[model samples]
Target: MSAENGTPETPAGSTPPTGPRPEPIRFFGTSWVGHDHGYTARRIALAAGSLAAAAVACLVLCLAYQGLQIADIGSFVTLLVVVMFAVCSALAFRHTWAGFSSRPDPDRQASLRGLLTIGFIGSLLAYAFRCLIEAPGEKLHRTEYEAARARHEKRTTRRSGNPKKRRRP
Candidate 1:
């Protein structure tokens, strides 16, 4: 009476078992939706849209960086901007993911609105902080240049076009 064969098995014969779950799938508020093959298409489209948005943002940032290179403090500013951008974006993504995981059916539009709102606020705050932090450097430079120009002007006198001295030598 082997356990595999139920030779107890033949006392009462049986066979080995193998099969998937008997339970039905529930997708998008409807059962049996997972059985259909069309969901993959929807998933692909979603992925493509996300990739396109990311590509556009990256391209814009790279091109715009070249124009900003004239600033002496551009490297520090650029580093701050990039770090802030990444952090804010990560936070927005986290908020949306949490919202989605908690809800039976999340309000996607609300998530989008929230994401945009949060991003704009973060950008504004970062810009304000950067400006405030950089003010001292700008102020010092402006005053230094002004003072140097004033000193130079006072120390040296400009020559008149006409010479008044007699030419006898």
Candidate 2:
């Protein structure tokens, strides 16, 4: 431990430990750490932009559904299509939201690719939702960065001993 600050000291002859650098979140960069460089403004813009895009997509989907209705497609078929899209969207939203908090399984993500593609609107909505609160994936990146800093501190800490004064073992 260091006498000056009660923190561990780096070993002599070794470079001093610099704190771990934070990994950048999408669209936020390192600004999330200090909320500098217009982070708040960027968040607001992204949230609004994504929400507007989702609204436009919903309108397009509504038009397509109306087209199907005009074609006299069987009621059962139209209902099934609607249900499928709804289920896919809900699943995509949940998956995307969970991914922001932790590393997702690659195989699972791969399997969900089709569903996610079909329900891209849900992903956009999730992004907007997260931006309103915090940068997406910010928490997970912070956790990993903290763990790395701890590891660096542990590795660089000097052991308390004088080799010349110790008895040979």
Over 1-169, each residue of candidate 2 has an lDDT whose tens digit, in order, gives: 3333223456889997577877777777777777777778988999999999999989988998999999998999999989988988899899999999999999999999999998988998999999998888888988898899899888889677887888977
- Relative to the unseen true structure, what is the C-alpha lDDT of residue 140 in candidate 1, on a scale of 0 to 100? 37
Looking at model 1, the pairs that clash are 6-9, 7-10, 8-11, 8-12
lDDT of 2: 0.86
TM-score of predicted structure 1: 0.40
lDDT of each: 0.45, 0.86
How many backbone collisions does model 1 have?
4
Query: Which tens-of-lDDT digit does each residue in 1-169 have in candidate 1?
Result: 2323212222346655322212221221111123233334433443454555556666676676665675556688988867766676666555433432233234665656655453543333333332333321233344554566676666666665557674757
